[model samples]
Target: MASFEVIGGRKLSGEITPQGAKNEALQVICAVLLTEEPVTITNIPDIVDVQKLIQLLSEMGVTVTREDEETYTFEARNINLEYLESKQFVNLGRAIRGSVMIMGPMLARFGMCKLPKPGGDKIGRRRMDTHFIGLEKLGAKFKYDSSDEFFHINANGRLKGTYMLLDEASVTGTANIVMGAVMAEGLTTIYNAACEPYVQQLCRMLNRMGAKISGIGSNLLTIEGVEKLGGTTHKLLPDMIEIGSFIGMAAMTGSEITIKNCQIQELGLIPDTFRQLGIKMEFRGDDIYIPTQENYTIETYIDGSILTIADQIWPGFTPDLLSIALVVATQAKGTVLIHQKMFESRLFFVDKLIDMGAQIILCDPHRATVIGHNKQVSLRGIRMTSPDIRAGVALLIAALSADGKSVIDNVEQIDRGYQKIDQRLNALGAQITRI
Candidate 1:
């Protein structure tokens, strides 16, 4: 129900630090359920989705102590396993997609867990098959109830590890399976696992907690089951999606903004992908400095073909930032194609951009060709609605660069990912007001 009233055409200049990774926070927070010892986590992003997950864990008797605004210590020594069957738990679980991850640790330690259908963005159909299939490989049985839309999962005894070849490289699925395998009877090998920086961080943290996990940053993961795991402190990397969004915002609004503590090395191919879009950025230590620019041109292929930017697996451009790249291309000097291969409905938000006077051709559900105005045609601000998290931020960036004022409703979607985005951007001279 919240909205953002953004006044466009204002140049922003200041330094903003990206928040901790949202994806990583969800995974590591759920990993706390694997051990009864206290797990201290710092640099946690205070976003809506993460807060919901923390609340869920606390309600399950996980003894969550807030050390500070960005730090917490979780001890799951007295978990109330019976809470899983309550309507309150189901309501809370279905509200956020991250709640599904707790099932892995629950079944691994407590022998049983139940989950309602998880809810998240309506971008596309996100299946739980990968998670179930991987868990089943380690001696787990699952039953689905169509009447109540609940999933019942149980293991007769301690999980027995085995090898699994995932049908897809799903990040959350891989994290769940790895958590289930960490305390199994034998070794577990996972192929085609998602090797994003988030997953790598989880694996490293697991190893720190006395779990034998190798292949930290590759598609193949090897896990040697241990009888138990202990607590360890973990810190999250800066959110690369937010860093990419900031770079796009700077290019579109002719702003000179420096993003601090970006963990640039873990942001694989993100900087280079934005560079291909002609957004100039400098890497100063761990910070990214994007200078003011009136115009930036899109780069074409060597043989004069129109450049196509598509989302692929890790080490490739992330699908989460494709919307920002598409928006940035609207004001660039040349044409570029944005291929959103991961989600079919993600590119549908271009209709809002079109209403703002950007020249974009929605080729299909999966592709869009943006013909840049090169700042020749100033976009006129208008009222809009945020469809999802990434697209919401993309629209907000467009509104910041438009000629007049714009109101974006349903900003809760944006808050699910970005941490106080309006306040952070407003600190950098952006006129974004929460209404």
Candidate 2:
């Protein structure tokens, strides 16, 4: 029940180090169930979701040790499959959608996994059908109890891999199936898979655990089943979503900030998407340097065309970032159409922007037309509560650029991803405080 109070119109000028990727950390933690040896993970973000996952793992009898503040050593040698039936497991499952990933490793290792409906951002209808279908294709039987809101999966025999064409490029779906296929009995070919950096990191971690996986950075992946996997130490890549958020925050507040230790290579097509809004960034080694500027303009296509920023599967712009991009567009000069194709209700938060004097046309559920301020008008400060992870960060960016003090409630939603966001912003000279 924390909230952020921000005094706006402050030029942020300092260096900020981005935290480890939340999405990748979740998958890597779940990969611990693939081995009995201790898997030491460094640079782990101390976020609410990771804490919840650790609690869930401990409830399942995994030896989760906190070596220090930002390091954790997990050994799932004597994991009790029965723990999944415990109320602690069920409650933690409802806190993070990533909890569903445990089902794959548990079923592969222990032959059974009972999990409740996973909880995450209520953006839209996020179906687990893709995950269940993918695992079912790999010789797992699934049972659901509507009244109890739990899924029972059993795979007594060795999983037999098969070809799977995902209905959609669901990120968690791809991660779940990847974990299941690694310990299967045959070759697993996944087409139209999610190839985001986080997913790729999971594939790499599995490979480190002796799993044979090809097409690491492509939508089509081939995973050769292995008999066993061993523990390996893996470091998480920097969160590109946080990097994108910093880019938007710096631009909206006309701040000069350097984001350090960013995995620039993994930020594919993200920089280009931000460039459409005329947010210029310089890459020096592992750092992205954003210089202070006045009057940023939105870049359009040739022949006076309107620029459309949309999200697709891998190699395409990510839907998770579209919310931040939309807020950045509001501060730029000119207009652009922000299209969120994957989730229907994601753009519903733009009405709050319209209330702040930004020109935005909500074109149905999937699209919004944002007429940039051209540096002509500033968004007035408003009190709001965060709706989801991405939208919460978007509101933070808007609050940083507004005319007066703004209060953003429900900051727990933002904590699910970004770690120590207020401190990081404060390091960048942002007038943000958690109250």
Candidate 3:
């Protein structure tokens, strides 16, 4: 239902603006159904899976116009497509795993799309078989009813692009096969593609509405088959896993925080994986700052070994921020090992950080280890619950570096992806109440 409580050893400071980019606004709000002209988008991250895919594109009519709380203006001219063979878009498209990327722009503009069975963040077997094997290798035709689970898909006439190769590298299956190879008709070579900046800002908003992609940020994508696709404004790109969970909640509450407008070079390798758990980042121009330190040590591997951190694919190191780098390596100073090679249950929430005293070691469903305790025994708060969405904001950054109160029941799985996250960590002072 609703719970947060928090309170812990607080220390927070100021600047915090990293919203907009819930996985690139669900692949740029399904690239506004591949354009019917009028796609305004902006720093949109009023989360809940991007407002349930903009309320399922206004229940499939698409014209969503807001322009304020983080802007919007979609306008898929007049789409209803029988509400994608409704049961109410299959119960609002099974609560968003990016609503299966609206079957790649509704099978590239209404060649039939009807999906269901989608939902997100169980953190495990998330496989729409590479989004229907790259939209059935761009010719589309993937049935799977199961008496009404639904995933029908079709491409009745025009959809010809070719060359695929993607077995993995599926950021929403290469953004639903680059929104069905940008209105497929000709060239489309996607090979192992998933160059995420949310698929390079959905290939630069489908090349400013006129698709022709071309190896953006690498992994080889090259769309170029446009017959239609118009409106464009796009702007999202800040949430590098909520700026690596506010640089791991300002190094597990030593807090000096300064995040603000953080586009700091698309945060590759997430500030060197939290400086290999030593914290202290500084970028300034486009802000990252994060200072307030005391200890933070953990760096090893030049041969010394014992320093794992893992999670590759996209300048590597973002398996949704390795659960805020394993809760900022449990107050770093020593061990590391996160691993989490593409989810198994997202390290089973580190047994609620080893029941709140923190010394982790699950080392199973995709590795864990942690073991820092450098704050030397502070974490004490308990009653946790949140299961998914990056381990519920990594158990709300280990309940804001625990020490006292810490309720956190579900919290709607961190508000389906943090946006008003306890009112922006209560303006950087953070007590987080949201009950």
Candidate 4:
């Protein structure tokens, strides 16, 4: 385990660039298996999760070439089916949640695939029923191995596409089904599909490779099956979650920071959601500028009631940023309820903030009440342990603005999602040492 010792109360003034979106990179890297030709992707984030996925590809026999620090070409001409059944595959797949998506391309191209129970942050009951149900609707058979705890999916022949109404708008589930449906035998209509920018980018990249997908940014998606897909170039958008984290970081620390090349168009409703939390931002030529501020006030409804910040599916405030919002609200000038409806355990990290002298009420597993300090007093730092990727970054932000030395353990969780986070923040005048 790695830990970060942070000396707080430093005013960081500079510019920072958001890394390539991690979720988008996860989806696109798996799509490379949909074709034998070389697929090149640029602006890939060098985070642990992405690197693990790349390693999984190499283990499965994809020819991965590093073109540069931020670019890679992947060619899956000869996939090792034998490796798919080995313990190495199961161990590798069990290390990350995104590995479950391999079933889609595997069934699309090879008509069969198997995977062990994938692992990820235990934020909530992230059900795989949606993935299995959607894939089964596409004419695939599923079998579970009790001893091995592995899932086996097979199609007698090429999959026959059809209509599927997902029980929930699952992002990874939608991506998996879309990849499988692209090379199926007929047309596929997916209602109640996830229309997140990550999903839209996946569809666009597939379309660039000859997949026919309609309704790129809508909930209802229609995909016409094709015989094959060709390789093409794709660039990932800047990470919106990271951008949101930076916004929260700047606000909490009273730092004047510029976030560069943030694909402002793809980020729908995120800026406004932060604005509701009283973060003032400027749109400066594709960048987001946040000047230093002594205080910011939370906005209330027209009825003059306490504001409620909640997370929903895409086109709504993302659940990933709810933790960030909760942290930012701790320093604002009003009271707001942070509702994390999607994940039950995500709000539990607020207890640690309470130990650091924050005014937070853990109402329940899914909701928290934060009473802002109003910049009259600063937060006192303490030692803490990070629980997950998003929560770890929130704690890091809290530590940056705290009044004393703070040590964060389990920082590997932070590294899994963020690309060189300590170095990036250090460049902005933050004192963080990794040990």
C-alpha-based local distance difference test score of model 4 = 0.95
> Distance (Å) between predicted and true CA of 33, model 2?
0.5
User: Clashes in model 4: which pairs?
Assistant: none
lDDT of 3: 0.84
RMSD to the true structure for each prediction, in A, is: 0.7, 1.1, 18.2, 0.6
- Identify the runs in model 2 with alpha carbons over 4 angstroms from their true place: none
| TM-score of decoy 3 | 0.36
Candidate 4 or 3, higher TM-score: 4
Task: Give the count of colliding residue pairs in each prediction.
Answer: 0, 0, 0, 0
Ranking by lDDT: 4, 1, 2, 3
Residue-wise lDDT of candidate 1 within 30-138, one digit each (tens)?
9999999999999999999999999999999999999999999999999998898888898999999999999778878887889999999999878889999999989
Tens digit of per-residue lDDT, candidate 4, span 1-435: 899999999999999999999999999999999999999999999999999999999999999999999999999999999998898998999999999989899999999999999998979889898889988999899999999999989988899889989999999999999999999999999999999999999999999999999999999999999999999999999999999999999999999999999999989889999999899999998999999989999999999999998998989999999999999998999999999999999999998899988999999999999999997878888999999999999999999999999999999999999999999999999999998
Better of 1 and 2 by lDDT: 1
Q: How much lDDT does each candidate structure score?
A: 0.95, 0.89, 0.84, 0.95
Candidate 1 C-alpha error for residue 204, in Å = 0.7
Please, what are the lDDT tens digits per residue for candidate 2 over residues 1-435? 999999999999978888888888988899899889889998898888988998889888899889988889999999887677788878889988889889788877776788899999899988889989999999999999999999989997888889989998888889999999999998999999999989988998889889999999888999999989998888899888899999988999998999998889998999888888999899999999999978788988898899999998778888889999999999899999999998899998898888877889998899999999876889999899899999999999999999998999999999988888998788777888899
